[model samples]
Target: MQRIFAADIGGTNARFALFTGHEGSLGLDTVVWEKSADLRTAEDLLQIMQRQLQTPLAEGDMLVIALAGPTHGLRGKLTNGPLQVDLGGVGQRYGLSCCLLINDFTAQAFAALTPRGAGAKVVRGRALPDTESTQTKAVFGAGTGLGAASLVCCGGEAGFRHWLAVPSEAGHAPFAFVGAEEHAYQGFLARDLGCDMPTAENVLCGEGLSLLHYYLSGQFYYPAMVGEQVLSHDTPTLHWYARFLGRFCRQWILNTLSRGGLWIAGGIVAKNPQCVEHPAFLQELAAGGDVGGIVHATPILLTTDANSGLWGAARAGLEHLRGQTLAASAKG
Candidate 1:
């Protein structure tokens, strides 16, 4: 049996977990979440997690951290927080067998493979065809910012033989708006953002949620507060937010051609499933013009499992360990 330590480090929170067992059958042993801001000036999160662990770290255990931003090889810096991660240095400092770093959304993509992501509420389309096994699936969500990633599976009914998680910085891309009203709202966001055009993150995140509420109601409130209003009342803000999310998801689906499906994960949609459940959301998602049939055929699911990122990181760690064992066997 192999041991793995996995972390899902976001802008606001950092989650750590320990998993045991080989690839395809890992079990969670322990998990904890800490405020990322608390460790901004202190020791790195790995050290803190190590000390908090009931079972002390053992040599040869692998570590995999999923960061909230793009990664270059085994290192990445969080886009919305203060953390410059270097997996190689982490491995050296912690005396681990291997260390890996991946984009947080890529972790979500991998999570789609595990049972934790199963039984998702289908908000927009039908379930994947039974014959479908080898295809691409995508996941995106809005939180501190927007994130996206895709998973490429290769195999058949027997089961997937390989999986690849493709990370993206697509959130930074400019968002398109239709109609004069939307254009005016876009201008408002652009001016507020100090950019000529508003990116998806500027209009789809928590700040965006608050900004949208203010745009419609002329009153500023926290995301949670706005979420409460949206959940309780059928306000215009809810419809607009749902439309924007639907449009964004549609664009992502078209860009990735993820016919296998698109899974939505993030605090916004996960906490308030009604966001996607709203008719406006599906209307916008299915509004692909000539390609409406294609959009209609693609499955849409909402990921409600909060620990999905941790599970994804653990899955990644197991794959790393498997690769190492394979390499050693080939050499011997």
Candidate 2:
């Protein structure tokens, strides 16, 4: 039997859990959550994981971390978050085989495709198809960090689906500087807020929303309170956020050509479906120059799980481990 440990490390917090069993039988055990800022180093995570284990790790145990940052190869870093390190040895401390790193959105993309049914709801455009076969699909969302990934069918059992995930750092793209409002936002981040160039993440994320509201109306709200405040008080900042995100998502969705659908997932987007579905968002999405009408035709689904990084990490890890097992078997 094989055991797997999975972690979803975001800008704000990290979720950790262990799994025991194969694909269909995989279930979470000893789930733990902690603030990422509190743990300054990888060693801190290792210690917590060690204590959370119900039993000592055995030879076939594996670890997978779905990180909030853009992944470089197999390693990823949290933007203004945690220390990035090669986690290959993360399991060595427990006598496990190996560990894997994937972008948090990559993990979500996997889960977004395979629905738990309740998690996938069509929030805009047309109803989601039963399953997307040929056309590519995109999943992008904002929270502690902005995340993005593309999913397309690859191969699987007849009628079943296998997917390939293409992860991206699209949020890091410079906030589209369309007009004076956009330019002013950029200046505020660089001068008033201390952002260098101010990517889409600075304007669309939790911290960005708080700052936007403050800049627009002198009201102060933190990330935790931003969601509630935005709903309670509909302000120009919220409008800007909706339109900006509308354009941001519009471009990415068009870039991916995800006619299968465009899924918005993650803590921030999931918690506040109101923000994503605002008329401003849809209006801006359809306001694109040449491709505006094209975007309006795309299905938009607001997913509560945001790729289900915590669940995907363990399941994806199992997939990686099993692939390794098969390769080794073939060689032997």
Best by lDDT: 1
Residue-level lDDT for 73 in candidate 1? 87
Off-target runs (Cα >4 Å) in candidate 1 are: 41-43, 127-132, 154-160, 290-292, 326-332
**Which TM-score value belongs to model 1?**
0.90
List TM-scores for all candidates, in order. 0.90, 0.80
Q: Each model's C-alpha lDDT? A: 0.79, 0.72
Candidate 1: give the clashing pairs: none
Give a tens-digit lDDT track for model 1, residues 1-332. Answer: 88888888887888888888653576888888888875542137777778656555554388788888768887788877888876665565667767888888888987776666555667766653332356688899888778898988644224334677888878889998989999999989988878998889888889989999999989998988888876556789989988998899889988888888888987788878888878888889867563646676788888887789988888777666766776698899
TM-score of 2: 0.80
Candidate 2 scores a C-alpha RMSD against the true structure in Å of 3.6
Window of ten residues with lowest summed lDDT in model 2: 110-119
